[model samples]
Target: MTRRDDIIAAAIRLAEQSSTGQANLSVRAVAKEAGIGASTLRHYFPTQSDLHEAIARRYMHVAINDFSIDDSARDPAERLFECCAQLLPSHEHRQIQLDTWLSAHVNGLGPERRAPVRRLLEHSHEVTYDHLDRWLQVLVDEGHLDAAEVAPSSTALFTMLDGLALHSIITPERITVDAARDQLRWLIAKVLEPKS
Candidate 1:
């Protein structure tokens, strides 16, 4: 592989394997893993933020592309649950990813590094929100949810997802992935249930 590809692969490996996530990513470390000098790696990514942006873009791309609900499933509620489940940090690896990213955002190397990390964090949340909005809209169209509930429910769902992620990261033993999924489904069911 080329030097650039090698650097990216090394970065990805660190991000995927480490609990601290991309916060643990370092030029010297990645360069060493890629069998290159630090200067050479710097040539490709002059700043830590540049490397972070690349990792964030690639990671988010894969995450979004990987989130798939089997279209063959006839039930819209099931599909919605699947969609939300896909977005949750339900697994150890996923929780690590979210924690690592959030940690970097909060404790970035410096202002220079923090800006790109901020952008990455914001972009990821927006991507998640967009996905939820689409799922909620689908349910609304099917008459399972009210049209007016879309805006409020979207915010609520996103908040719940974020809360779940935080609890998963901070107190994982307290909230298993299955429990989190069940709670998410309950929220959806409660919102969609008809009132007298």
Candidate 2:
């Protein structure tokens, strides 16, 4: 990878490792992690805010790429449910990203800092909405749902998934992944099941 890519990757790793309760992030630390001199790191990222923005962008890109939509499934409902399930963060890295986002909000890095994060957040929402939209279109086309039902159904599913993700991140003990999955399954069944 190019030096810029290496530096961005290192900054993301550092951000993941260094939570809110940790020491301040430093160019020297990121440079060492990136296997480059601080001067070289500065060449690409002139300020800590620049590096932080790069990290946030990279995190968002990774999250977007993780959304695996399986269109080959015979059942449209199953495919839609699987796609929504993929939006939830894994337990291994969810807290790290959450911590990084929360840190960015309070760090007072100004527009330079907040802009990329805001873009990332918006991109994530758009990606999720796009997936839900497609699912609704498929259901409507298959005659399982009416065209008029698409928008409200898609919004409900998206909101349910977002709420589950938030609850999983904030109250893992109270709402386990299994519970979230079960809730999602029930919602999916309610929304997509035929009017038998």
Using lDDT, give the best candidate's number. Answer: 1
lDDT of 1 by residue, 1-196 (tens): 8777778888888777776523468888788877889999999999987887887766775676323333534566677777777767746576566767468657544455666767787778787777777777777766778888888888988888878877877777876788889888998787777866
TM-score of each: 0.65, 0.58
Q: What is candidate 2's TM-score against the reference?
A: 0.58
Relative to the true structure, how large is the alpha-carbon lDDT of every model?
Answer: 0.75, 0.71
- In model 1, the Cα lDDT at residue 63 comes to 73
Highest TM-score scorer: 1
True lDDT of residue 155, candidate 2: 87
lDDT of 2 by residue, 1-196 (tens): 8889988888777777876557345899999999999998889999887887677656655654323333444676676667777666556666765455455444434455656556656666676676677777776776777787788888888888767766766798876767877888888888876765
- The weakest ten consecutive residues by lDDT in model 2 span 64-73
Clashes of 2: 0
